[model samples]
Target: MKTLLFCMLGLGLTACGSSPKNAHSNQDELAMLVGTYTNGSSKGIYTFRFNQETGTAVPLSSAALPNPSYLVPSENGKFVYAVSEMNNSTAALSSFSFDKETGELRLLNTVPTLGADPCYVATNGREVLTANYSGGTMSVFPLQKDGTLAPADTLFQGEATGPDTIRQATPHIHCTVFSPDRKYIFATDFSADRILRFVVHPNNPIPQTSPEAVDIEADSGPRHLTFSPDGKFAYLITELSGKVIAFSYNDGRLKQIQTITADTVAARGSADIHLSPDGKYLYASNRLKEDGIAIFAVNPENGTLAKVGYQPTGIHPRNFNITPNGKYLLAACRDSNVIQVYKRNEVTGLLEDTHQDIVVDMPVCIQFGNYSARTKDTKN
Candidate 1:
């Protein structure tokens, strides 16, 4: 009865035993994982078959859970970790084992995030980390051999406040990003306007190194950070200021080199950031007044950004990602209830809308994984 109720609750959100077979094996099929806000039509994590060659996608299956607003797959693509962005004590982190052949996600376990409204999750196959937004903390969970979480080791954000009276009243850790080498974890605090780095210790339950930090401009609201494919450069996108800060990374240190304007919309709510597979271009999503993606040309020599173009998107494009081959870019529009697909121009590094969108309620985060050896790229 519980299973039946779950299916009913998801309704059009998921299909039972309806995953597609491995057709066209000659072509590269990558699994696209989408995590959504579940207040509306969305149920939980949605899976799809994305053809790397054709740049097309088809829905596969869905896992019915609470608001998994952000998700990250294990390095080996065997397990996925998701955050339940609920309020207060209801917030939690979930683990699932993925089946590539069937495009299914089997629930492994659930554990409290030790914080509230966890907005981001990351894992290096050794431990899982979550950035809890409302609770002003971060949590680390050691991975068991069976791909389940042991207990959580929480790290308090340690008293941070920004200029915004209401939004920056306290520490709000927006994202926990793993370094390219997987030896360090960086957490961005939106309300705090700071980025803190922690050393990873597989043997120790807590973070080490006293946690080095870099502060942003007052009220800039640092949201998310991404690294270049080669890990030589790091880019941080700020929400309030709508600026992209370029940094040179070495060992485990980040040094700011440039700050460029990406989204200057009246209600600047810049969200996610990513680089193309080739690392020639960068894209940042902006919300509120003008919902679109800002395209910037990455200076390969200096690690700076120059505004190239902008593509208007559905609504509230909180998160988006590029394909492994860098042929297509998908935007998960949270308010528009669809994932817009766009074709990439290799020579110019601009985006052209394909008009092919996948309809799902309140889709926010998009990730590409469960890849075959031929279509896999570990940069993201």
Candidate 2:
């Protein structure tokens, strides 16, 4: 009779073994690793603690750094590089040490941008690249071991020579980014309507000058550029012309393949462009047409794009980021002072508003970092 009772208990345990609690536990772990951003005052930087799961954010601390507009994390996630959009002739890039555990930022050092009103920055390995919008130049800086930025090593002044007085009066280097292979540095010049590419040397702090830069169509005003995950194609968004151009990239060369209007309506423009991690979707932000995001589906075989409709964001979505897991998107609506959240549909390449927003003053950027395994194991 005791053996019979034991056999019955084992059968019961095998019949109902699924655990809903374990599924919920995994979801909770996902939310803890999301990062958050806050606006530094016109002359400062703000920090925040991010709850990755529920899209909740809270201010952590603030540091005074003049006109901080853009932030780029170091390769190791230990430092954040920012640009001060100062009109002063000596505007610079500032560095901060980031506490991954606390989401706090401590001022590290500043490096001269060698240009005025430096607006955007990007990090490649141990070097920092900056684009000065007002000064029409690009600069490269070395990153020190302790999360500080060394002085600028290379400065390239953009030149504009055209008849279009309104748009091409002078050079405006708007954005700087590196290729996926880290072999080339690409800088988008708005006033010059060109995408300049430089060959990067492993030991050099600055990219070596290359004669391979590609000039886009006149008055297109290329603002931001990104490559597909496979690096087979490149996409560029123009701020002035409201166009999204696709190019075939082969062996570090770009050849224009197609151009489509980013504007759903007749005359609107875009601010930024980003590719989905899976390389199936492309997104561009429209600022003039009442704050909307344009979605495009990429054709893998030909590297072309098809319209995937648009979604309305908050007012003036200056910059946005897709979470690492590709589950959510956060848009930094600069004017509304809110970072709006959206759930992304992987199958359809569409976004649905989550109705959850993080309020901060003049927030302009959003980024993500993965939590360490030890922290995850302990359930932080």
Candidate number of the best TM-score: 1
Model 2 sits at a Cα RMSD from the real structure of 11.5
lDDT of each: 0.83, 0.72
TM, every model: 0.92, 0.85
| Per-residue alpha-carbon lDDT of candidate 1 for residues 251-293, written as tens digits (9 for 90 to 100) | 8899999999888765769999999999999999999978999
Count backbone overlaps in model 1: 0
TM-score of 1: 0.92
Candidate 2 at 342: error in angstroms?
Answer: 1.0
Q: Highest lDDT among the candidates is held by which one?
A: 1
